[model samples]
Target: MFSFFESQRLLFYYLGFLAFALAVLTKGIAGLFFGPVILIYALINKKLIGLLKNPHTYISFLGMAVLVLGYYFGREALNPGYLEIVSFNELGGRFEENLGSKKFGYWYHLEGFKNYRFAPWLLLALLALPLAYYSKDDKLRKLTTLSTLAVLVHFFVISSSSTKQPWYDLPMYPFLAMLASIPLWILYSALQKVNLYSFALSGKIIAFLLLVVVFRAPYQEVWDATYKPSEPPWNYETMGSEHFLFNVLYGKDNLDKAKVLHLGNNDHLRFYKKVLAQKGIEVELIEPENLQSGDVIVTCQAEIQSLLNENYRLELLNDSSVYRKYRILSANRKSPIDHR
Candidate 1:
């Protein structure tokens, strides 16, 4: 959008406003920062007055407002308090309070660049900024200025927020990558000059090698996360229990009649319950006092021990480290309970 505005592409500028509206819908208020970013660019370029006088700017603003407000208002009408929830929980709370246990200082995201979160690219991007800003090409300098402004504005806004999450830094990566590309292209061009015993490698060969070196770690990381089978513990007990439930629900003998009960509350259990529901399995929450014969229970080791101490006989089905599955056989009422 900034590029289009810079190049005086009026049609694309209007379309960019609509695109910005979609971005806001997809990412909540984080997308609103783009407006301030562009305004800052206009001010820096001394085009603020011209931009304000442009009637298409007002028309574009109206279009964007209609698209964004239509969805928000429609949702609020259907679900009362939706706007309040979004404003308070999603936006306002993040700015005013620490919402999670894993809180970090303001420099958290900035430190991530050194800690392999952005890595290699972020360092190179920082190095390229000065060169990009002072480039002989007018277009390059303009773009560098705009991108630098965006990165600075976004960084400050997110870093100043009281609540922080790793994924919240996602939007900044694209602009950083744009900055990084200048140095990468320069390196690729330099690589093209390499000679081995009077033999010159083609630009294509250099580019291919450069790409392989650049992408290898990220590619391997993606492959390991998605396709590779995870080892125990890292597989997470909740995930293992999800697999166990899948097998039981679709077993050859068809234990479809078995009552599946989740015996305790945990973050993982709550999250995977939704995952299990998506696969057509329903897990009911059951208290220890409600234990009944033939009920298939899913719980942690401590809860299982508590059940055993209460004289409830259970046949262990599967144990996934922290979590376990068991079938209640009987409760021996006459037996003395072990307080220990």
Candidate 2:
């Protein structure tokens, strides 16, 4: 980012600084590396002290420091244990627990590289780096080399972490795209040299082909969206089936006046509560054993048999391979005998 904006207008330099601040705010520690990344770029360009002496650099750092420190203090003030968790428990053993093991950290990142089912694309993108670094074009070589270096740094940092997820590599996509385009440039140059057509016409064709290759996945996705049935709203981002469950309810009943309850974690319950809150409908999450008279509970098929023995009425609402939605009737507290 700094490289792109360094030689631009004065406004662009400040804009670059703002971009760095925003990155840190949104991405946390991942974005913090931008500070060192830019500094290294300055050193590579033989402007190390020149960058440090620049007032904009200091302003950017000051802004980010204030934002981060203020957030820390605010969180600590709100919850006394927040500081302790942030300092020790937040990422300490948490990643290992979530990831299951640290041995596959590098493999997990490699697997994530083919997120869109295009493994070869990433391999080709990597191959472009050396070519870009050694190119005859001074501007292209320098910019590509810098971008590739930044991506490598990001990759190593993220891969070293105990936790991993596919979208964690999003920051490297732009550099990958730039690197991927090297082959097209080479193809274009070869075509122009062959004199098959005017240089201008050949260049236009190559540009169009490059764009087509770049946008192929989007084109395929658009086609799928046009013809495919509406898919279940199972989002990995939230790691929940709340949206699908809600939509199932939406089809058969009015949520505004419905009695709703969920049997799950606080995070999942919060999703249900937020959706039902404005309508003055309170959704309660109850223990399976504490099944009371007139209690409505949401649970899956696996627990239905156990609930049945306790005299809870079950109505199947929606069924999926992974999760089955059911409306559990209240337990008959008057009699200990099973109704089913």
Candidate 3:
């Protein structure tokens, strides 16, 4: 039983489930890369350790795991596409092309760009700092430096051409560890050089500062935003999709004034539309046969949700959850709302 849990295949399979949860809860990218990238890194590192005779092989594995997991959960994500880098909204819409072309989405229309916030800058800073701080103790300073630079260069170059996301930056975490390991590692090369007992003050101070920095404002936001719903119509606190959609579809003065569509698939679409009807919002649930040419679609991240191409454009939207309402749905916003 213990071995099964520890087995790479089993571990990755479980983590892949987590990725699915993540994909549904927030963005699909987390679930997409979480297991795959970590498994790949473990395999690569394990191979390297096997080629050499070192007493610290197990210790190195532990350290690498810690580093990778830390970066995976702690550091900023390198998400792909404009949604990670911008804000977009879809009011009472399931899907719509040219509805708001500038809105951040996965597919590129003839439209140019939309919101470009500080996410990119923040991600770069995250990759450079603490990793370097932690790696300061390593002995392979130069090798680590060159190697890290190479990795960073590749990451930046590859990402530069394509769209960007917070998770996309994850590929660079390993490299940053390489750079960060240089300083402290040289000092701790052996117990005799300075001894682990020495420089207790600096370690505590750095650790405290790191804890503060790493667990600062973003951590709070992540905790809050992670568990809480980001928008209204969908309770950030509860399963609000049904309530939200119903209200949007038939909530007195809302349906008539709004153009909406469920981008991917929500089996509950009919259920929610029924709720809307009960609330006096008259709406027509649709299939491809019923689709209008210029219908507006309200899209959210729907993991593995299937839909007919003729029914909706399959537009994916990110979250711009304002208050209790899920305001906008970018292609990247996996809100667990689409239960197709």
Every candidate's lDDT: 0.72, 0.60, 0.41
In angstroms, how far off is 254's CA in candidate 1? Answer: 12
> How large an RMSD does model 1 have?
5.2
TM-score of each: 0.74, 0.67, 0.31
Error of 3 at 312 (Å): 21
Tell me the lDDT of model 1 at 261: 41
- Per-residue C-alpha lDDT of model 3 across residues 109-222, encoded as one tens digit per residue: 101111232332334434444454456534343344444454545453333323433344455555545544443333234322332457656555555555476447767878
Backbone clashes in model 1: 0
Model 3's lDDT to the true fold?
0.41
Model 2 agreement with the true structure over 1-340: per-residue lDDT tens digits? 5444446465667677667667655765566654666667777878788767878778866876787778878888998888677555335644444554435646576566767534657766776767766678877776776677777777776676777666667787777777777766766666545534455576567656766876798688789889873444543223324544465346533333223333444576466667765556555554455555444444443434454545666666545543344555555456554323
lDDT of 1 by residue, 1-340 (tens): 7767667889788878888898899988888876788898888888889889999889999999999889999999999999998898667897888778378898998898657777767778887777776667677777777778888898898888888887777788888888887777767776777775666666557777997998898899899988974545754433544554545546522334444344344455556456667777665655555666777776544544575646777887766554566777888765444333
Q: Who wins the TM-score comparison?
A: 1
Comparison by TM-score, 2 against 3, better one: 2
Give the TM-score (vs. native) of candidate 3.
0.31
- Cα deviation in Å at residue 261, candidate 1? 4.9
